[model samples]
Target: MKLAIVGGGSTYTPELIDGFARHRSALPLEELVLVDPDPRRLELVGGMARRMLAHAGHPVTLTTTSDVRAGVDGADAVLLQLRVGGQDARSADETWPHEAHCIGQETTGPGGLAKALRTVPVALSIADVVREHARPGAWIVDFTNPVGIVTRALLEAGHRAVGLCNVAIGFQRRFAAALGVPADDVLLGHVGLNHLTWERSAVVGGVDQLPGLLSERLGELAEEVELPAPLLAQLAAVPSYYLRYYYAHDEVLAEQLAAPTRADAVRAIERELLDLYADPRTVTKPEALERRGGAFYSEAAVELLVQMSSSAGSPLDSPAGRPRVVNLRNDGALPFLPDDHVVEVPAVFHDGRFVARDVEEVPVEAQGLVAAVAAYERLALEAAVHGGRERVLSAMRSHPLVLQHERAEKLTDLLLAENARFLPWAR
Candidate 1:
């Protein structure tokens, strides 16, 4: 099958290629096309992918191109993994609104708003490319950040898309490791939205394990917390940077403030990564992989085709004796929230079809938050697509944290002024 990876120049290209190569026997990738605007980076990643494929003894044809149209033409699956702007842009995103409001910019705070504004256009453009060139019924897997929002855009555009985040899988693996169980033996039920998702329930050895039992050993789970925010938050609900910001503001900020913020502190760790990539090493080199690790995150985006096309006409039965993913609307599946939001759950896939496991309602408090975020998400999209300042304001108002800050008006004013480049309606 022809598979195209957009943003092939990304630092994660090596890891993705490695993943594809590792799973080639199952997916049987025949042609791999790497697309990026930077020719130098494209050559670098392309060379690495080819090397990996060769090492795997997979006779997959490899192609590299700077043009999306050319690279994606007739592709079975197109992976969208581009960065709108790199770290420098993120630094700006983190610092801008915070500098304006005397509050530090955060992942989901005003900083997230600004970053999303900068990102949506590029995301839409990539979707447009797929619309023009992808094979009929091709799948578009988005590994972009602010995944909930990006996935919404693709769904709105009537594209077959699913957002893939590796955090859940990484945490699941960590949970198994912590329990001294095989990774495949863990069964997990995931809930919440985007990075906010929690492993609502987990089963080990066919026994249900409550998160409370696991949280008792806080020290042991620190590494897992460091994996990603949503998963980390689920595991460590009361403390830590990511969840604390959303829930326990005073405590989380204090922790961050106490930590070193100097550029040297940040760059010290980055220097090691840069050094690894700087080495003219082969793709299979450990040093190269270590450097590439941070950029890749342990997540992967496998087109349904790769899984379904290759499967032996059986439904993609949900893995048994372990937690698996099942996607469904939020209404009957989740008692607390409205019925229409798309949620992922543990399920079995057999043949090519999926059967999601039923889940109980989320707690009232949690459901309320999800509802608020969903409402805001809808309004944000409406404000962006149509023109409505009130819609945007209402959405922001609905966010409990925004109200808690009492800076909603100020944030709204600042966002309207700063985001004019993206939200022309605000003007």
Candidate 2:
């Protein structure tokens, strides 16, 4: 199959390629295209893929290009891994709002809004390419930040797209390990937007296993909470950050971590992980390029696709020939969402069609939280398009953080100042 990776010059390229290597036989990839604006990065990733394949005695026709049309033309699947501003751009998004509003947001909130504004146009531009060049029924896998907003835009623009993030999938493994069960034996189910999902239920040996254990570990988990969100949500296997207001307002997290603030607990965990990654013997370098002789590689979606297609474990019975997938457009893909929310969920592929499983709807409370943030997202998009400060302020008011209209206005003022570079078109 002809597979294309846009933004192939990403830092995570090697890891993604390695993931693909694990299922190389299943994929039997004949052509791999790496497309990026930056020549150096494109060569780096494309070269890496070539070398890895050569070493493994796989004769794959790997190509690199800056032309989006050339890269995506006739492709079976296109994996979008774009970062419009790169690290410097992301810094502007994060630091601008934090500096202006004194709110440290890396992902969601004002920081995310600034990022969405800069990124949405670029994402749309790529979508335009898909419309022009991609073969019929080609899948577009989006692995970008502000996933919900981006996927929503793609759907609205009448394109086929799915937002993807490994956080939930990774957490599933962690939770399973914590419960002393094999990951495969754990029947994990999650529902919600990216980075924000409620772990619905988990089963071990066909028996419910999470509730009893989580009830006991609640106190300890609260003491050293690494993931963001509220303790109650944590108990229910939900992203802790969903209850961000409680953490800041009710001091629920503080009381839960009476000995140390939740922030403090996070610091300790960060330090430990950093220390491990920083260890001299850890070889933190990207050795795949050196040992394998290339600059870039494939990613998780590619590797997983191969496995599912090959029936290595259990043949994906879905129509698309992929084992697990994340999709946005509701053609009965997800039954629970409002038919508009871009949800990430497990999917199966078969008969050249990606089929979304029956995903349960998020709880009413979580839906309200998602709606609150979604309202801000809508306002942000409107503000960006219209350049209206009042509209931006109104959008900020949609967030729970801006409890009052006055605070929301003040927050908008701060955002305007901080995001000036990004808001030349906005008023």
Candidate 3:
């Protein structure tokens, strides 16, 4: 199999290379192509990736290119990991939202809207290139930020795509470790739109162990979710860390104001990572890469690809039974949301697509938030594909974080002005 990574120059590339090396047997590769527009980053990251592959004794052919069509040609699958306008744009996204007293997060709130507007167009154009050049029936595995929105745009454009996020798997690993079980044995009742999800139960051997785990390890679970233990007990569900911005908005905004933005921290980390990659002796993925975030990303991405590829023989086959959390169109998985809405839920690979596992109805407590966020996401996608100040403002107003009309209008202006360079339509 030939796999192409569209944003192969990212600092995250080496970690992915390490994953492919470790799991080479499960998903054998004839060729691995790294595609990026930045030649300098491609050289540094591609050099490290080759070294890592060699160190692991995995002799898969490695190649690099700036041309999307050339890299994707004949490829069985293409992975989208590119960040439009890079981390500098992200830095601005994270910093500017504070002016409206909103959470300055890259995947939610006003900042996420800016990112979606910038990313969706680029992702669509690349998808077109892949459609024109990749092997027939090839899948587009998107690891891009604002996964829900990007995945929605891809699917809406009639492309074969699925979004991948590391949050659910990260929680699975942590829960598995605490329970002394394999990560695959840990089943999470993870549901909602990407970045806006909650784990209602953690099952082991067909038995829900979340209640006991919560009772015995309340402090530990609270610390992991970054919420108060009492709150966890009260809610009887574990929200993703991103939920902290919504549940404790004022407190989080205050903290964000005091600390340096995450983008600033990432920039510093990327510089150090590049320096390490430049060292000839540094072949293995450095431990420092952990601070760069996206923990368990490589594992999640590899598992999804392997599952999808293994089912190629029967394009419409149902899953073999094990469920994995994925971001794809709802198709009634949530019941409450529209079928076309992109949601992150526990699903299994069947035939050549993802079939969302039957879920117990969403809890009453989560219904309103889930529906509201899904609505906002739809509006966001519309604005992203067909740019207009009013559409942008409407999407902003629909978000739970920016619900007021006046605030949404103000944020719309700020977003348009700050992200002008990336949002060509807005400019």
Model number with the top lDDT: 3
Report the lDDT tens digits of candidate 2 across residue range 232-339.
Answer: 544475444434433453353234333433334434543343343334343323442333211222434654556334442444543333335364545544444456
| Highest TM-score against the true fold, candidate | 3
Q: Note the clash tally of each candidate.
A: 22, 24, 5
lDDT of 3 at 189: 88
User: So what's the TM-score on candidate 1?
Assistant: 0.81
lDDT of 1 by residue, 50-169 (tens): 766787787889999988899999998888886665555555555444533433442465655555555666778888888888898776777776666776777777776766666556
User: What's the lDDT of the predicted structure labeled candidate 1?
Assistant: 0.60
Report every candidate's CA lDDT: 0.60, 0.61, 0.90
Q: Which stretches of candidate 2 lie over 4 Å from their true place?
A: 99-102, 179-182, 215-230, 233-235, 238-300, 303-327, 330-337, 350-358, 361-365, 381-391, 413-424
Q: How accurate is candidate 3 locally (lDDT)?
A: 0.90
Q: What value of lDDT does candidate 2 attain over all alpha carbons?
A: 0.61
lDDT of 3 by residue, 1-427 (tens): 9999999999999989989999999889889999999999999999999999999999899999999999999999999997998888898888888888898889899999999999999999999999999998889999998999999999999999999999999989988998999998888989888998888899998898888888989999899878889988987878899889888899999999999989899999999999999998998999999999999999998898888877645443344447789998999898889999999998878867788985555667879998998899999999999999999999999999999888888899999998888777766
Residue range with the least summed lDDT across 10 consecutive positions in model 3: 312-321
